[model samples]
Target: MAGRRTERIDEWRERVDELCYDGERVEHRLDLECATVVVTTQRVLAFVPTTAGPAFRHVDRPNVGTVTLETSQRLAVLCAGIIAAFAGVATLEMATSITVSSAVPSVDLEGIAPLPGSNLLVGFVETVLAAIETGLLLLQWSVLLAGVAALVAAIGLITYYIRSRTRLLVVRVSGDDDLVVPVSGVDLEDELVVDLEAAIRPAPESTPALEAEDGRRTSSRNWTEIDHEESG
Candidate 1:
């Protein structure tokens, strides 16, 4: 598992490397289950690749603001949705089954001649229930497939939660969405966080260099005055 994680990080680092402009160097990167946050000298970039193509969001280092750990309900909400979907699928299947099974007659209708017409009625009811069950089964098929997908998503998110070391970093930026990176397995406590906070922090004011030559100017007016006094 650790080896696979390394490979994944390497792949993202390559991708982040490709997107970097000439002379821009990657300093720190936080790899998440669904996205990657990369900090460079010039800017901070968040990448989330989709089926369509690669997606990107970034902020210049100057614009990167205060970074704080915000409590996240994203995992909780997703888990709830997955649980609800499974419950719905089970409930639907249960209801359909109950309806289907109840229509069968306990006594044999074929043996009684006086209730010949009654047999047809029972057969009609059974046929209707069967059709309903078929339709419900198709609906359940779709629901079941959706439930499985949710389950997979839940598992992935759970992995992310554990690997993040129970951390949620929210990178506040100016004029852009905050970079909410769900981190993956990496002990970047001293290195990565400092790099990001440095971006957020205002740069220290620089004092002007005193490199210019400082001297009293020998003015043309002073020369003219001296010449006039001499001529006088």
Candidate 2:
């Protein structure tokens, strides 16, 4: 029989371990690029890994006060601005430097020197290459500009994908400071939010004798919700 390999716990996991109590265990975890949001049996943990060490914060499940969202489009706007400037400069320079050339020189024989036994003079112009036509030059720059536009569009898409996704969750506790955790991807975000709500908000206790149509709403775990709350 082959033995199973155990998962290694690094420094970051150690930090996560220290955030929990002796009996508290992690229930749901959403791992992001630099941060992780964990829903534990008794708490919610926000862990950020850095060069020096792991920075971690947590709040008791019942003490959670407000959960807000912070969204930003600054990076996307900055990228668009910088690339627009670059494209303007590049197009202007090309327009100024790409003028039509009409200095083509043609060679004409003044006098003929005869060969040894023949009255014919064999002429060979060393450099007789014709310059590119004006229309063709313009067309070339047009193609180059198209290529540049394609490149800029590609960069814009890439920046939108990477730098523009700065959505985060700001969890505020009753007396503690807010814990900020970066979130990405729809699956992770949905699952984490669901687990967090389940952990904090209690489910109604029901027996077989209680019918749903005849029961009134219980207020055991009732909490007020502040919608559309923005955080920085």
Candidate 3:
């Protein structure tokens, strides 16, 4: 049983690695539940699990251009406020609807034909009551719809927070595509960036001496041409 469990765990890890990098051996790994970053010999891979599905991106060592970090506190607070306001309004409207529905008395206009002024008064009261009920019903529905919209917006904001609240590691690839990975904390961010930079920084070029030689040759040729023109 122990052997089987160990084998299963290994298989699961292998599956996850394959899903991200097609069997690349992971040299460094940071797991954040919703997001993960895996560094291999050849590339850095970021995986994000979203509502639609799991999204993954791989940045070749040579193609990594830059890394950045950011936060989203203001947007999160704004979304929370909107959600609370809509929820409060919805509750208030619902309570008002219930009270009005129960308190208002139903009137019957079927039987007695009364005095002329009495008839006008009765019709006016009926119209007024009906308008109030209709307005309350519409108001309740409108508030409910508003509450739903606010709830959706709040959920979206929360999702964004979950994906971005932590120090976000934003990797810019050579072709202008960016791969964002959320790290758990600032320490992790610093450590990961250091590791990535060390791994991906290109080796220093040895072409400076060649470039200087080429410049010297070009200058000598120009001087030779000028001397020949003067002689002619």
Q: Over the stretch 119-220, how does candidate 3's per-residue lDDT look in tens digits?
A: 887889898898888887787767677766666766676676566555666777888567775555534644667766555565455588878999999999
TM-score of model 1 vs. true structure = 0.37
Residue pairs in clash, model 3 = none
Query: Can you give the lDDT of residue 159 in candidate 2?
Result: 70
Query: Residue 103 deviation, candidate 3, in Å?
Result: 34
Residue 10, model 3, lDDT? 46
Task: Order the candidates by TM-score, highest first.
Answer: 2, 1, 3
Q: Residue by residue across 1-232, what tens digits does model 2's lDDT show?
A: 1111111223555467666779987777766666667788888776654323336666778888656566645666666656665775676566556545543344454444444623333234322323335455666578567657756775676676567666767677788666766666552454555555565554456754465433433322232122223321
- Number of the top candidate by TM-score? 2
Minimum summed lDDT over a 10-residue window in model 3 is located at 47-56
* Candidate 2 or 1, higher TM-score: 2
Ranking by lDDT: 3, 1, 2
Ranking 2 against 3 by lDDT, winner: 3
Runs with alpha carbons beyond 4 Å of true place in candidate 2: 1-36, 50-54, 66-72, 75-164, 174-176, 184-189, 203-232
On lDDT, the candidate that comes out on top is: 3
Residue 80 displacement in candidate 1 (angstroms): 12
Model 2 has an lDDT value of 0.59
